[model samples]
Target chain A: MAVLTDEQTMLRDMAREWAGNESPVGAWRKVRDAGEAAGFDAAAFGTMAEMGWTGIIIPEAQGGSDFGWLSLGLVIEELGKTMTASPLAASAAAASAILLGGSDEQKMAYLPRIASGELVATLAVDEGPRHDPANTAASVSDGKLSGTKAFVAEGDSAGLFVVAATDGLYLVEAGEGVSVSRRHAVDFRSHAEIVFDGARAAKLAEGGTGLLDAVLDRAAVLASAEMLGMAGQSFDTTLAYLKQRVQFGQVLATFQALQHRMATLFSEIELMRSAVEAGLTAIDRGGDTRAAASLAKAKANEVGHLMSRELIQLHGGIGMTDEYDAGFYLKRMRVLEQMWGNAAYHRERFARLSGF
Target chain B: MATLADPVAETAVDAFRDEVRAFLAANFPPSLKGKDNAMSAVEGPTAETPEQAAWRKAMGAKGWGVPTWPSAYGGGGLSREQAKILAEEMARAGAWNPIGGMGVMMFGPTLLEYGSEEQKLEHIPAIARGEVRWCQGYSEPNAGSDLANLQCFAEDRGDHYVVNGQKTWTSGGQWADKCFCLVRTDKNQKQGGITFLLIDMDSPGVEVKPIRMISGMSPFCETFFTDVKVPKTNRVGEEGQGWTIGKRLLQHERTNLSGGGSAFRMAGPSLADMAKHYAGVDGEGRIADAELRARIAKWEMDWRVFQLTALRVLAESKAVGGVSEVSSILKTVGTKLGQERAELIIEIRGMQGLGWEGEGYGEDELHSVRAWLFGKATTIYGGSTEVQNNVIAKRILGMLDHQ
Candidate 1:
């Protein structure tokens, strides 16, 4: 097992309890059945805020605990075990960008509300079909921003938008010239395509050039942590099914073929866990965050997808139906697999960072 | 990247690291730099040239050869962290650890745990000083995976035991000075009937024949003992208790085979460096071949992940005083990755990878082929991959027994 500090262990246990009791796979199923437009339970998000998770990475002066990225990642991982859909990941990412590049006045005005869950924010960086941080076509000219951003997670619910433009990162109010139309995502999460038609915006002090890359790398690490949680869940659930399900006059897990496959997946998941932990440690310790983040994300993307696919295959035909919880994990894994950057994208980025 | 939480210990370790770095810089032979010493080969101390002998003697005298062992036993008596620092410093200087063999990897550790005081005094110091070579005598013709099925027998004859058996795959048997053997003492019982004995390889009636491998090197041998006489005092533990001792020793062997103690070393140039030299870079400073670049990137990422996991497992074991069954996990994955790396090197070299000899191929290119061939045994030696899976399934996952 990976070593964890006392505080981290406490946070993990608390998050696990919350996910098991307050929000679980059944909760997501209920939300899906109710046809919720926000794609997640708002009341649960409020409960999370009350638990001080939304402020986990924010500064103490900003009404946060200042626990740092690793703590936040622990919480996210726990929630991911049940595929809990919330704005925590996106909002935390948006908060990180502000903390990294936001001016003091900007931080003072927005961070408190964000930490309190009174305002919802998310990064809108992707402007095209691909997951390219540098592919932004959005432009900021004379205090105004105009362009369309696709796959803006939690865009429909956000009150603040951290818009990435060619010039830099600009803060835009989610009112007036901002029109957010909810986009149907394969994962059934609340994602939107936002069109900014000359919206008045505030440019961060160090917003342009490399700011988006920095924020993306941080977000990628957090996202990989979530993927790790999901992959673990899928693996455990499959193993349970394998043990209980009997076929051909014996339990499925008794077969050497399935056991070998499960063992292989187990090893891959363990590897991913280490990579994700190292990434968070890198961010906390000021290491080569870009390369570490990319490494984690790439491994997580590959392993998460593989485990989910194996979960379905190993579970047999029942896994294909919406009635089984396995389908939800598969769907959620697909979205997370492509979020921030997919395996191929990060692999290329890792190569470039490594000077290949 | 995080600063050590314990500043005093950190400073001490830092000072130790500098001392080690300086010593290695002064003493490590420049001629031995970049030389492939066949560290994985289990063969006995081959007749070393004068330089190799001097280097080994220097390291042995400094007691840094086996840094973690007790100083009372001729070792450096360093902490695990200090040992890690020493290894890192040695790697940074492109110098290999001068002391390696079954003694350092398995026999010494086992003896430290199970051997009597007299035995420890006699053997551990010699091993620590790099003066003795040891070979394992666990498997026989009938007991490769079912190791307890071994038929080698030792009869108790008052003050001594007369042993007779054939042990196959006795690595370095042809040149080893000593053998840590497992022999049957009571044929009526299964695993309980075995005994662990330490015998001199030069004992009368002991014979060794090297077995050639596909790579054209014989790191292993077949040993036949015809009524070999061994003193009863040579036994490490009580008779009929070798099973437990043998299993424990294998844990150490598996850990060593998994590269747990050594710094990650590449047998040839790094994948990226090889790619750049063989496949020129594109205008964007990327490998010109897109597919090859992606493959190399994925392989490097996998290797990094494995390395990080190894470190995490080590740190966890150190903090909490127990080793996880993840050693099996490490062995399986580590060996597979090593093989994949070799395969990729061959792939990147194309036709140059196929050369067996001649000036057309660089030394690294030739080494790449041999390394690839030798790597196939890694998954098979310590424990076959299938056997590891069975262990993981039963021990870690709690899977049911099918048979």
Candidate 2:
């Protein structure tokens, strides 16, 4: 972990305690059983906002504490441990778009509501199966926007959409020409396919052409933080199981083969922690977010994939049962691995940014 | 205004940079620009030219060579920020620290931790001045991986210990002025039987024979002692406390050998430029060979991960002081990656990378081959990768060993 200020330390501890007490994985089981279309508990998110999590990255002028990215990542990571499902990451990302590129009118209309959790906002960037922000086909002409966005996380509940267009970003309310259809992917989160046909749009005109990529970078870092949380939980759970689970009259952890493999996983997780923290720290420092984001997401994808798989295999038979929490982590790991950008995508992106 | 939390005001930092520049301008020889100190744990000390001797004396006296060490013991005693500025200024001036050896890398810190004030006053100043060379005397012929199995005995005399044993893989032993030895003080106990003793190489019964390595370098030696008398006061800590002190020193060694700090830090041109020069690049400026390009990309990304982890571990260690189990991971992965990078360099240059001791190969080319060979010992020494895994598993991950 990076060196934490007293405030950041308190925020992290609060988030951790809250997640453990109120929104454990069992809480997600309850939400799943209820079949909520948004894939998360709304009341819980309101609780998060009341605790000042929603406005962690927002400016004080805009009704937020502007605590910064690393601080926000800490809370999101804690929530991630319980598999707490919410549009917190998406909404924060959308708020970044507004803060970076939105006009004063746009900020006044949206920032306060997003900070208060009265509004659900998200960036609608990808138009295909994979995340390719550079190939965005969304177009804004006249006072309208039109495009079909694929696999938009939290789209079903989002009240405001920051749609990426060929020229720039456009703010589209979830009414009139905007329509969202829920998609139940493997992770079973609140993902949607949205189609916009001449939606009333407000162009985010300030930060220029780089704003879309920059916002996507923020979203990528957010997703990476979530993956770090999941990876850590999976690793811890698997380790505890290894100590208890017996094989041939010895605990699995006593076997040198399993022992070394767990050691390797420990190293991998440590590396992942470093990468994710560095990404968050970069954003906080206003450094090169593009490289750091790609690096972070790439390691998160690889490590998350490795860790969830190991969590299953290390547990042997009990891991395959739906009754066990390993399957949830595994499924969520797959979905998050593909969100924003996968390992291969970010690796290539990092290479390009590094000039190969 | 410099605060206690971060005492690096721009003006103060700038002034330190200026001080460093003036020091370098006066001390560093123009001919030594871009020249680096050879790995002191490996190569024997060469005779220095007059200018080189002068430069070493100036930097050693100024204590800039070991900048973060305590100034009371011939050290610069700079803060971390000031040390960093010292490094940056040196890099900008193309000068290197002339002082480094096993003493600075491993022994000094450990001794400072566990040594008596008398020992500190005796040994540390010489190390800070780069005046004396120290070699480890831990690994014996029978105690390679299971280091505590070492059988070197220190028979108790009235005022001194008569040591009799053999130690192998004593790096720079032939050139060292002193050896920090681990000897058996009690036969009844295994780890507790060991004692940390300081032995002078010039003692009558001490002998060192250089062992030639696969890299065609005799960097390591077999050291033997036959009733060598070491003063009782030379023993560090308690007699049975040797294992603890020795292990603590190994921790220092492990951290230093973990690539970013030292041992495997390769300073030269980048691997990509070599790839482009030797293998060629495509129209898009990517490496023309697709497989090689992918492999290079993987190595590069992994290398970046290691670097980020290094930075994280540094921050973490600073926040919660002391080295972490992550340092074990750093040693394991970092050494392996350093070897991988060396392999990549060889593959990039192909035949030019395999030269022995002849013309047609540039100094850099020859150095890469030798470095690659010697780097194999990195994972083997300072606790092997397998041992590091056991540490991570048994200690960090709380995996129990089979009884």
Report the lDDT tens digits of candidate 1 across residue range B158-231.
99999999999889888789999999999999999999999899999999999988766788899999999999
Question: All predictions: root-mean-square deviation over Cα?
Answer: 3.2, 3.0
Q: Which 10-residue window of candidate 1 chain A scores lowest in summed lDDT? A: A205-214
Please, what are the lDDT tens digits per residue for candidate 1 over residues A1-356?
46788998999999999999989899989988876657889999999999999999899999999998888899999999998989998898999889988999999999999999888999999987679877778998889899999988889899999998887888999999999898887777878999999999998876546677788988899899889999999999999999999888899888999889988998899999989999988888864589999999999999999998998999999999889999888888888888899999999899888888
What tens-digit string does per-residue lDDT give for candidate 2 at A45-123? Answer: 9999999888999998888899999999999899889899999999999999999999898898899999999999998
Two-chain DockQ for model 2: 0.62
- TM-score of each prediction: 0.93, 0.93
Individual DockQ of the candidates?
0.68, 0.62
What residue runs in model 1 are displaced by over 4 Å at the alpha carbon? Answer: B1-46, B58-63, B71-73, B76-97
DockQ of candidate 1 against the true complex: 0.68
Please state the error at residue A23 of candidate 1 in Å.
Answer: 1.2
